[model samples]
Target: MIMIRVILIMLFGRCLSCAICSTFHGWIKKWIQIS
Candidate 1:
């Protein structure tokens, strides 16, 4: 049970980071387009 919880936490963290990275990428693209 502990192991499962740990795995889930890691997966959630990875997904959150991915979302942040994609958002940043989009922001940069929009910035470039506007400039």
Candidate 2:
């Protein structure tokens, strides 16, 4: 159903961003330490 699909996209989008930000921050920390 449309409602179900919308909910799934919203939940998945947030989760993806949460994961991305953590990885991005981790890499930034490493890069700063190396430099």
Find the 10 residues in a row with the least total lDDT in model 1. 16-25
Tens-digit lDDT string for candidate 1 (1-35): 99967865776567756776567557768999999
- The list of candidate 1 runs beyond 4 A from truth reads 1-17
Task: Tell me the spans in candidate 2 whose CA falls farther than 4 Å from its real position.
Answer: 1-17
lDDT value for model 1? 0.71
As a whole number from 0 to 100, the lDDT of residue 35 in candidate 2 is 100
* CA lDDT, candidate 2, residue 27: 76
Residue pairs with backbone atoms closer than 3 Å in model 2 (clashes): none
TM-score of each: 0.51, 0.51
- What is candidate 2's lDDT per residue for 1-35, written digit by digit as tens? 99967865776567756876567557768999999
Model 1: per-residue Cα lDDT at residue 32: 100
C-alpha lDDT (0 to 100) for residue 28 of candidate 2:
64
Candidate 2 matches the true fold with a TM-score of 0.51
**TM-score, candidate number 1:** 0.51
